[model samples]
Target: MSVAAAWARCDERVVARQTLITFVGLRDPYAHDPHEDGRHKGPILTLLDERSFDRVILLGRPHRADHSERTRQALKELHPKLSVQVIGLELADATHHPEILAKLRVVLARIRRDGPDDEWSVSLISGTPEMHACWVLLAVAGELGAKLLNFRRTVHNGIAGPRFVRELGWGEPLASLRPETLALLSTRRDRWDDVDQQGAAHTPPRHYFSRAILELAVNLSRHLAPLLVKGEPGTQKHLFASLVHQFSNRASGPLLIFNCATVPADLFETVLLGEEGDGGDGKLRQADGGTLVLIKAQELPAPLLARLLKAVDDGHYFRARGRTPVKVNVRLILTTERDFEEEVRLGHLPVEIWRRLRTALITLPPLRERPGDVLRLAKDELERLNRTLPRPKRFSPAALAKLESHRWPSNVSELRRVIEHAVLTAEEPAIQPEDLDFELAVNLANVFTAAVPRLREGFSMMDYLRAMKLELVRGALRKTGGNQSKAARLLGLTPQAVSQILRQTEARE
Candidate 1:
């Protein structure tokens, strides 16, 4: 019989007996919350309850069985007729074991033969890649005319969908899913798009130099395809890091970020590399198969840097004092304010490590060169801060003009702080010039002056404009210390525009 016809036959059998659902997981702490009430139960238990499945088989590593058993017991109590099975596999035996698949097939086959008198189905709940492999096995049984029920985690309402199944990719399987399944997936995707749109909409105003910094970020992200950015204080390196993460191939992966500066230097290595005991594998291991963003990497000790560099080069980490080295395929994106190239040149950084990262350099521009961005940033920040504060507020035209005219030595971060401060301190709906931190305003006014005329005769206005633009660009480039996106935002231009301008300038030169 055809796969669809077979699935239809199996569906009739499934509705007759108590349906069985299986959960596959690798000991995650987040999954350990007690499910005594079963109201706010774990994903597996929740899926079973929602589908009204008669049985649930919880499978996980032996180390995690203690926690899994608690959940299993909760499921039994919640649905008195529901049967619960708990299976534990050795950590080493998980990925390569054929028995796991065999046991899973046996469970599904049994459920197919003895249909529950009431409505029932079986589902496998798994978030880990290894556990996800079970889908292939289930799909095979499904092909053999055994009824298969699949449940995917939903970001909203946390409910499972009941749908008839066929071959995994024989046709467009996702398209054939129940309306509820499609709706949940659509909602999750829309939520992601909304975040991206919100971030893009908040793009700050650009000054002359901002474009250059953005260019640097775009170039580094494109050429290197993946990179680690390190720069000095007030350089907006983190902003560039965010841009890179947003634009890279692994953008879909969780953007796990940790600042080395905020974390004590003594614990920096442990935090970045991760620890062994207490289910903590450190940052490098946890971020395995995803992107591990280390902000303020300059603060890390030389030894920790060496370990990280080794992991980056080898694509796996040799945990300190741990057993076997865990193989982790991860993209390392480190950001720092320190001039690592200089450090490498001065022999502070090893030559091998420098060689691996030489091509991925991205410097961020400081705030001073991108004066135009100041007003825009102020506006955006004020708008955001207004949402939190008691009343709506706006920067007066004169205040905005004053902001644009003054140099921002502290860059975007400083600008954000100033706006937040002004919002907090302002008495009225309008932010007057006096409301702004006068000290910052005075400091900025003294820093920037009108462009001095070039002594070289026959300098065209176009040439002057070009020169001025380049100067601002270069300054912003230096200020971001060389993150391109922040520079672009600082310049009120797109990262792509900044890169094009730079390329054109380079060609002309």
Candidate 2:
């Protein structure tokens, strides 16, 4: 017996209660039996018309030597309100035997274009070879905005009976399947999983990065903009690198990134400049026509820094292993916590390298300078993390406020770690202040304590507020290239309000 038949027999109550039912069949001999008709269609149509079922699916037996077209014709005549899909056994040519997949796609597309309403019942007919066809069908259901119902089969006296009924959609069950299905489900799901499993945490997209960071990315794209983004550990420098890559002309090209601090000094030269060993080219050659993002570039030794600066200026490098000088078409993006100028003055970086970097210099303000961005980043992180985990978790208002009040020394990265940890450890659905780790809470408390004394001593809150407001406004303006409407959206204010603020700040100046 088919899954749909087994479901109808076991949970007749729930089956009779649905408004529409979709009967799914695998190719089998029993599916061709004329007496097997009422299992999916009759009950589903009864419920839908009676406000019990809106949709129903029936799985028909596979078309074999003994199977007749009478079953198909009978089903068509019986369930006119039901949409029938035949999952063909032919895998040799998808183009020729397009009936099953084609009809399925059409049904799904209709669901996508026009959502499920009171008008129709959905049903599917297939054979045994198409057992795995559930993946494609479920995906179609998801595309059409249909919630999936989990119906389990029960066997009584060696006869399969539809007994258990539970409903779950594409997320959980699909996640449990093989990786291939996960890849086809949603683009974001695959990306999130890959990044998470690979231990690669992404920076928030362009929509979430601060206006200052966005502006810096834009400016960097226009020229070899050397930006010193100084924020506590989690400030999202990697995300900023991705944003720059997105904006640059080489957006389609390879984005070669290396964490300078993590790599040893000996490997730095070979990694960045590339070596001939191990059937590979050096980093410079690999990143030749694209961007080379060096995270914590300040950590590199002076000698390596000089060599790097030479490559950036000359656009070419001679590998230590090989003598041939290779001309590289590369863009240099360096992230550092130390002041580059001070480092140069302290003879850490060559003066000539500083000259190459001076043309486009962007200084990223710490998270403390952009409190408004805190909530935005938190929301983005929550949405991203929810995909991988089994349960749903959201931040409470108090939790968000606490996050905003704290000085994010580690920046976005640190915040993500804390939130991920909290989500993993929490017993309830929502993340609260108590869910936060003690160490993080203590650090945040210290920040508040330090700021309180300054505030009490007449630390000019109005001036500080005005300055931050101006910086955000200016950063938005810079990001949008003076487009008032876009800048207004970025600042989360009305266009007129942004204009008014801009005029008021100008007058004050």
Candidate 3:
């Protein structure tokens, strides 16, 4: 489905009994409020009497079975022949968000199994805020093609009546949800408040260069055929893709991510290009009118890369069994840790896809390159950990110095873990250098093992040792920012000894 066609879908109202599936929320047993009486009574009466629904499914906490039964009996009094299904959740408290979402999933799964053909509608009037949020998420995800039925008492009649909101069906994304609901579900509530009628994009990272890269990505993400993002594994490749998706015109559409490294080649092809008897839509169709993030994109086999290239160029592709090509309006954000030039040279990446990726190529510098951001990100992570831990702790001068000086091979991900561990184990008030749990010795050992292999297999052991020493000296110099004294200190040797070793190594080279 094309993006424009999906957005142009008109609101629908289902009236028939067999086609109608109503999920009504049961009233809280303890609540005794007059103004909120429309919570249960209004939506039920409207659906049963006005809409003529075939079945009204009542959902509530397991401990409140009596409340659900009482509501069912009362509804029966109004329409005795009306089918009522009362379902009690195992949860004692439905107020928590995770619990509500988990229970809702079970309810949704059962509905799909029992009545696959029924058109469903949900009442958000009576459940807890968590329940309402969960229902909204399900609807927004298009996992449930359920219409949201709303009811509020009119001032003129002073009685609740059927109010048609909007229907959530296949192809509809989260942007179709009511603005208020979007605001409530969004974690960046502060940013949400600043947005205009058309929801605004997320703010980019704090770094100046990152912000510039994000600006470029946002522009390219909207209209480009296929954008390529190049970075190391922990260099925020996926994070940048999300930012690009959020800031683009397709922000309203779904952002489906698939890691080429994780998915098997055959299964991935099935997910990307649906087969004739697949019985369901492929991820390409599922991500229509949105963005698709392909992680480790360089790992894609040659044939699959060609297929994706064709899809991007033509804006359509044939499904497994379907003869006719299905038009798709999805933005592609391909991320890879491998070098694009090297891949092209090795024929790992097809020429056509490589050309398509030329539309936009974003390279994210490693965290070590952005040295200024380290302390800021570390402190921010510390603040985040403080909220969950027993006590807040600040980094000591020595600890902070070590953090700044260390060569973070895994980039931001490694730094985050280090900070999390330090926050958890450090004493109150201040985190000392010892609080930071690092395995430098283990890393050195691994480096040595990797640098010298087959030493016992007729290779010269002294030559291997000399080569390792030379590499270590060069690495130390690079890490210490060309400071000989600092490099010597890092290698646990005197500056004069380091100078002599360097001179000897240079002469040998």
Specify the highest-TM-score model's number: 3
What is each predicted model's overall lDDT from 0 to 1?
0.55, 0.55, 0.64
- Could you tell me every candidate's TM-score relative to the true structure? 0.45, 0.48, 0.49
Candidate 3 displacement at residue 178 in angstroms? 29
Which candidate wins on lDDT? Answer: 3
lDDT (tens digit, per residue) of candidate 3 on 39-131: 334445544554656677877566767777777787788778777788777775665666766877888888677777676777655655556
Worst 10 residues of 2 by lDDT: 190-199
Alpha-carbon deviation at 111 in model 2, angstroms: 17
lDDT of 1: 0.55
Model 1 residue 236 CA deviation (Å) reads: 3.2
Native RMSD of candidate 2 (Å):
19.8
Ranking by TM-score: 3, 2, 1
For all candidates, the clash counts are: 34, 42, 3
Pairing residues by index, what is the TM-score of model 1? 0.45
